[model samples]
Target: MAVLEGDCEDSVSDSAKSCQTQSCTNCGGDGSCNMNSVCNNGCLPGFYSLACAQSCGKCGGNGSCNRLSRFCDESSCLPRYFGPLCIQLCPLNCGGDGSCDFQTANCLQGCKSRFSGTRCELSVACPSSTCRDPCQSINGGICTSGCRSGYFGEICNRVCNCQNNGACVQDTGVCESISQTTSVTVPTKFSDGKTAYQRAPAEGDPNNYGS
Candidate 1:
């Protein structure tokens, strides 16, 4: 008589020995003998999954998977393309006109017009000096369009050396040279600067800032 097991009917063939516990029919007793379970035949040479429903195609030669299809596809973006789908056109508004390979999310070949560094993430750094010009080396200034300490001129190039309580104006980047015994010098240059500096900070920097 056939014995009942979970969802499977266990029975011995007429010619077989006395009834015995049967292994899985799917894996052929490969230790994964469970009923209704899928087959894992190693599937072709590059196929995967127990059911082998996914195929990596010829692009799988490089051992890379396509994010969209989960198949073996190009690991990196192709020429002129740089995105997971290899769809982003190069030299777009990636970063300072940097060249971004959307496929890999990297700035390969080269960065945008003025951008530089990895992924074109770094902008032109300012020059070094006691009172470094905010936009010394780059077209824009560090503090945007504003007057520096002890300075009050177009582009904040003039020195005001106000010998009293003074402070730079907000937004306008103007300096208020308020001297104890002298009148305060109002600001002249207007601040007009916009930046998209990456929030990723150094090791000690606050992690929540970018969040």
Candidate 2:
């Protein structure tokens, strides 16, 4: 709804003409005649014009793009971002919003927590109290890989010391197939000598002679 630069034409003279009427005669609610009687109206938010059609490319702070050029206003892009559309991300670990200079790639405002360096590129180690795995400093400071033996958890902090010579699953710490524990459950056998070694769970016998 803001006034943007434009001019009413004089076909023969090829120049802007003063208003003949007192107020604007022809224009939509979104359009206007300026104080100087110049025909002007900024485009609706997200729309540049019928020629460009549709959304204005991610202007910073949700500001409207210029109606004609559609370029973002200077310093209008979000922090740590820049480019034709302001969709480009700043280098990793930049501090405040708009902190990364799109031109220089430096964190001019300093680094985010747990990240250090002129450009905020280095990862600072998290204390074991917060993140148990030393692996947090590596792999972009995320510990997604499974924990070492004898430990398990989201952060691989919980102990997995299974009791009685039991082996634990690295993910869930559930005791599983180990020396003393047998998952195989043999079925009960019939009294007859032939059925003594038959399948355990099946009723009667393999010969079907005895119940």
Candidate 3:
């Protein structure tokens, strides 16, 4: 009476355990053992259902699907692909392997000769600005979470100020805007939104704008 899943007594033989891949015969594929040793890990990619007899829609990059409920991987699709699990392909002349926008599937590299559209089929979406935050750098004037690697700023709009691949502080903005040889103007407006021209009341200096 094996009742605690994989905690089966070593006395039980492989034949009695189900499959060699450690897959459950009850699950028809990879699965964990239940109290009765019934597996439930689900089936291989592109398969579904208890018997694992169903086929899934075309997924991105031929990725896998939820074998148990048929849920699809929305982000796994390769370039030129879109829709749920990337089941759909971009237009024929969408240009550049259909590496279109993820949201609209519009090409980002522009259209081919004699073919034209407002977006040129070449497109892209606001990619993640930071791994920990969503990207809306264009729409949002300021970064809510922070900047991505190799970048730092309030809105994540400014490029890495350091040369030779140096890093900068987030709120400090202390890094050089460019390499030593390059001539570039630095931006003002400190972290507190005050400039060198503006006198601080705390410093006993006369305020320029208002009290």
Quote the lDDT for 172 in model 2: 71
Q: Which ranges of candidate 1 are over 4 A from the true structure? A: 1-63, 66-141, 144-148, 151-158, 164-166, 170-177, 180-211
2 versus 3: better lDDT goes to: 2
Window of ten residues with lowest summed lDDT in model 2: 196-205
lDDT of 1: 0.40
Q: Which pairs of residues have clashing backbones in candidate 2?
A: 79-98, 187-200, 187-201, 188-200
Across residues 88-198, which tens digit of lDDT does each residue of candidate 2 receive?
Answer: 777777766635664566676666656666677897663334343444433333435555555555555566655453445656766554433323334455556443332
Question: Model 1 over residues 34-152: C-alpha lDDT tens digits?
Answer: 22234323333333345333443433234344323554454554344555444456644244344454445555554433344555456644322313234432332243454445544
Where does model 2 exceed 4 Å of error?
1-29, 32-40, 97-99, 124-211
After superposition of all CA atoms, the RMSD between model 1 and the true structure is 18.9
Lowest lDDT 10-residue stretch of candidate 3? 178-187
TM-scores of the candidates are 0.25, 0.35, 0.34
Computed on alpha carbons, the lDDT of every model, listed in order, comes to: 0.40, 0.51, 0.50
How accurate locally is residue 186 in candidate 3, as Cα lDDT from 0 to 100?
A: 42
Q: Rank the candidates by lDDT, best first.
A: 2, 3, 1
Residues 7-84 of candidate 3 have per-residue lDDT tens digits of 345435455554232333434343444544344565556656654446666565455666555656445456666665
